[model samples]
Target: MSQQKPPLQNRVDPWGVLHAVQARGTLMGNRGILHDDQNRIVRHWAGKAWLSCVLNPPFEQKRSPFSQGTYSELFFLDEATAFAAGHRPCRSCQRGRYDAFKAGWAAAHAASNPSADAPTWLPIAAIDAVLHAERIGPDRRKRTHPSALAGLPDGTFYAAEGEAWLVWRGQSLRWTFDGYQRADAPPAGDEVAVLTPPSIVTLLRSGFRPSVHPTANLYN
Candidate 1:
């Protein structure tokens, strides 16, 4: 009898790139039920809101990862990937980080808005709504905004030459599951399509540095 091939892994990078890897992730995120009846992830997401969460809760009962569930357990390369994927830190398991993220997000927007009545803090729901629209289009492909590569903050991803490249410490690194490959820097003034949302980009510029993969260090 022919042995059945192993099921495909369901890990996702910040840019919504899927990977079938043996290495485990440190955090978990969700994009609703992207899987079908057979528990296989389809090319499209079933819902709009994506969320970033801790691996496990201290008080709640633990379940196996990727167990049959209402939501798909998407993995990230790091917190940077999670944020870029349009997920905010979980309010329950990651309260401290969540608060910081909220504050930074609010501050970033407030700076850009420059309105006297802008609130100092915005609810998570509002942030999620904006992220939902920015992360994906009506057809579920990754949406991008036009911005200069130099203007985008560290931890942002941009599309160039038909591939996603990560910006880190003033350099562009080609994204790969194994590690990032150093690539030629795009023109500082040229407009490029930014993968990370505008608000999150502001947060990064406002000093909310997300964790990056070790491979990023090689370029620095």
Candidate 2:
């Protein structure tokens, strides 16, 4: 008999790809408890509010990862992938990162607004609402907006030629569960479909650095 794979290994990633790898992720989120009777994540998310989180918490008891539970245990390639999948940093385990992300997000908006009445802070709920709309569409496909590749900061991912590519130091690296591979850079002035949310992109452009896979350095 063939070796059976763990259910979580079969889970689909935010980029609409499936893989089995050992790289640990730093974030977690919920899409309304999407496990089946056999504890497999189904194709569709139950609702909005896809979240980002830290890997583990001291308060929670140890249990089987992705066991039959209220929420499915989804993993990402990195923080950039999590953001691309429309997740923000978790406020509990990743409080400091969350605060920084929130501050960057608010600053991005304030710079764009630049009005005397513009709020200096934005509520998490408000950010989630915007992400919900940007991450998915009425048809449930991953929503993407046209953006210049040069304008995107490092750690962002975009869809091109039906594959996901990462932006890193002026190059586009093809994304994989194991690592990223070298790929063609988008031509100057070309507008490609951006997977990461506009606000998160703004935060990245504003110098909010996100963690990337170690393999990302091989090409650099």
Candidate 3:
């Protein structure tokens, strides 16, 4: 029998859930300091700005995952999973992606801005405010909403049988901490529990493509 791995309290899943899986994570992230001195998760989040970053940040000083820090390090399999977990790109480590996210946001939700010039930039904190509201429900859990499957853009995720599946080019990819597997897409026009936040879903609809694991192309 396979033995259980020790707890790291660092791996994040598509539903914004944390686990201790021993799989490779392609992205790094944080939600402020969430662990105790003994490396146990003591809170859901320490702050509102949940951010997804690169596995190896080019500029930031490297530190041990277990090192005591200003924040607890969180890891995700890919940007798609991270977005499903309500995380946006880290402004510092992923500047280009962050700008694209803002541009996408402006195009998605602020297109109606009366100003013909529109907004060239939207504050990350403002986006965080909206995401915070959408990511958490009144029941204080990962909020879910219903959406038409056929209408969801690629990279969007939905809940089915308690697992998260990514919508990609008319196919559903089963998300795993290791990688994704192609699966039958839902029937045309079926409504499912959308796991990605509404605002971010709109962002995908606006073409802010996220980086996915290489296996995605394998199954594509």
Candidate 4:
């Protein structure tokens, strides 16, 4: 039997030669902060953070910082780096982008893929259709504003956790939460209501204090 030799140790700095003499907080342009754990430059833009994969990061064509454009706060970089930095999609300029990305991501995820039925990409419109089918309504029957819940186009509204989602098709509504966190199941024969970002923000701006964490703040 052959004996394996011990692995050789690298004498060079892990982050790179350029950063050898620099301190930890030294900003290297697009490199962001050099993290020891991942050995990559990590940075947070918008609401998410990410780590750069390569040294010379590519510049994304974005709105000028001084100019007033729709996508001013947008950041463009490798997907791997974006995920590492811990950032989610922007609800405004990146709304469509996030919706598409999330749909494709959910479809490819193993949790979405059940036995016998392969995972499929559902459109945002489909989600609306499915929820409409549920026909949810308030229990009190005294006319009131609907709860804040909206679905993507894929015929399903993904809950906070990926485990379950809401499916609405006209008056037939169903809340699927088999393997995830969920509220009480929708009541039978009730008309369900969905809320969009703009409406939610309008309520918040009007002094509506929400008990839960605010979602869709960027959408408005």
Best by lDDT: 3
Which scores higher on TM-score, 2 or 4? 2
Best by TM-score: 3
* Model 3 per-residue lDDT tens digits across residues 111-184: 53547676667788888988999999988799998988877899999988777898887788888888988776
Stretches of model 2 off by over 4 angstroms after superposition: 1-5, 9-27, 185-189
lDDT of 4: 0.27
TM-score of 1: 0.85
Candidate 2 structure quality by residue, lDDT tens digits, 10-120: 333546443556655545555557667776556557665666666665555574565665666667767777877777787776789889888988998788779999889
> What RMSD, rounded to one decimal, does every model reach?
2.9, 2.7, 3.0, 20.0
**Order by TM-score, highest first:** 3, 2, 1, 4
Residue 60 C-alpha lDDT in model 3: 59
TM-scores vs. true structure, each candidate? 0.85, 0.86, 0.90, 0.21
Weakest ten-residue segment in model 4 by summed lDDT: 8-17
lDDT for model 1 comes to 0.75
**Local lDDT at 97 for model 2:** 84
- In model 2, what lDDT does residue 53 have? 63
Q: Which stretches of candidate 1 lie over 4 Å from their true place?
A: 1-9, 56-62, 185-189
lDDT of 4 at 63: 24
Backbone clashes for every candidate come to: 0, 2, 0, 39
